[model samples]
Target: MSDLTGSTDINTANLPIIDYSRIEAFFFEKTAENVAENAKLLRAVNDVGFIYLKNHGITDEKMKQLFDYAKEFFSWPVSEKEKIESCESKFFHGWFSPERTSKTRIADQKEAFDIGDDSNLVRPNQWPADWPEFRTEMNYFFEKCHEIHLVLLGTFAETQGLPKDHFDSFVNEKDHFFRLLHYPATTPDSIGDRLRASPHTDYGTLTLLFNDNSGGLQIRGKDGQWLEVPPIPGYAIINIGDLLSRWFNGSLKSTEHRVVEPPPEWSKLDVEGRLPPRYALAWFGNPNRNAWIEPLSSCITAESPQRFEGVWAGKHVADRIAKLHKDGKAPEVWKDSMYREERPQQQQQQQHAQLPALA
Candidate 1:
């Protein structure tokens, strides 16, 4: 059904690609005159669940600054990086170190850093006090994405034939997350699937990805093949997540993807000449802590009927992401079962204890 096999080596030339013009028209075009445009966009979302966005309105200069800062930050010594390692309460919502987990299906080949929302609102980012430019640029990039997230949410609501503000009411208190990922290449492991990132689906409303040209992003297509998502300058890869799919009654698909070790060509360079691993700036768009997510009356059908009831968007996403963080350093395992992780431990333990232990 939905492809989750997690293919590693991918051919980008033959993939089902979507450029910026199509995406721009999809978001900016009028409903009455350009109905076909909207339909095409939605159809893509339904089938592939991922699109390469072009002319998305985010600037190249801004992207450069963000990337520069990210590289600088990651280049810092391990001791310095540890200062911001996510605290227990912060969960996966803050800074994380490298080599935390062996690539999901393979050996230790990649390293990364991650940052997300502070549900408890207790963890402030560990800024490099000595580097004002780094701090300023990083924060700016984060804030900019947070703003773009609002617009994207509105666009999503419009796509569903709902009012522009449909998602606004539920997302007043947001739980969004911004992360910078680094994938360093290393020797291949047994299966050769050592992923800088494991195959998984995002847990929130949406994911906006700023991927570099060192391509490794792949999406599961309807053909049951893994399609490589090539990089588009100034374009963000947009995809629906699990919660959004349920909320839309499956109108949008949360395609599975992973980041694997680089191809042989890219991996062959001497240590000093090696092509640097991939860099991606990803944002997890979340709703307010108490936002209710339910299928709109128009999207619900007899066949789909209420696959998922109204869920508190913030609590739902936050709880699931936190558990994934708690389970391990990488976010892959967390995508396996949303329900079990979505519930808090206290409630889960109580539910388990209530079950017939003898059985």
Candidate 2:
């Protein structure tokens, strides 16, 4: 396999765009068929921790409509928007009102709406139901995104030197949470704690980011400095997450990244000027709840063994995120007294059970 390291200055203006035909050619090729320079693909993944894609099967017209719709949804007055507050969901995991959240711990001057791939769990998002096009467009986007996700999985498998079908079994029933985020105008005072997203690795195997041209995405480099990801049009940025990072035996880094509000450019007329709100859709992919996540046998040998014990994709992700929120580490999910109250009793029982009685 080629190196995963990538260039430092990759931005929307300079990044490569991989359209649908390109993606199909690269991912659907038989093992016997030689593909384009595999090295270049690996270099994009390694150096930049991500890549912008174009000619990806998704159409520009669809994207434009989606963006316009999102802008409209986020623009609703606070009272009307709060009708379906995210907190109403059992998990604090749905449509969040504006300024209702920050990075897991630090405040983020942004707002978002979250959706999952599970048709059962994904309600017809609380659209302004009166608009007939609302449901139609949202569902269309979901289906299209779902299709793209499968294609990308095949690509990831090929990149790892595995068969294009390698990820198929584990992902038969996946949990892909799509979040549409809007970062509003920010003042200098809005910057807090050097964290736009807190330093945390995504808990899934991969992430697909559909970003706007106004870029603030940053990823940590091998040298421990953060590098900004320039938003390349026609290309959505894709990145490796924790599971993929572990699967590669550290070959790829699940680097840390945070978003920051952009400083004013000379074009802005006022000192308290703000940049246009940035919108990005992040699709996080995971295997079915019962799927076992052990190192792929092909990726390990007697010398390396296994780096992580097998884990259930669902519980594993939920627990890690829960712990972080409780410790004031990450702020994606809010905690309830029930979660905190039951903890001590469970710990005390475990402690007592482990103690040896005097003989």
Global local distance difference test of model 1: 0.61
Query: What's model 1's lDDT at 117?
Result: 41
What digit string (tens of lDDT, one per residue) describes model 2 on residues 196-238?
4455667777787887776667776666676666655556777
User: Per-model C-alpha lDDT, please?
Assistant: 0.61, 0.59
Tens-digit lDDT track of model 1 for 53-104? 5566668998998888777777778787766665445445345643452232
What alpha-carbon RMSD in Å does predicted model 2 have with respect to the real structure? 7.3
**Best-matching candidate per TM-score:** 1
Please list the residue runs of candidate 2 whose C-alpha ends up more than 4 Å from where it truly belongs after superposition.
Answer: 1-20, 27-34, 46-48, 88-93, 97-105, 121-128, 158-162, 192-195, 263-271, 302-305, 320-359
TM-score of 1: 0.78
Q: Report the lDDT of model 2 for residue 45.
A: 60
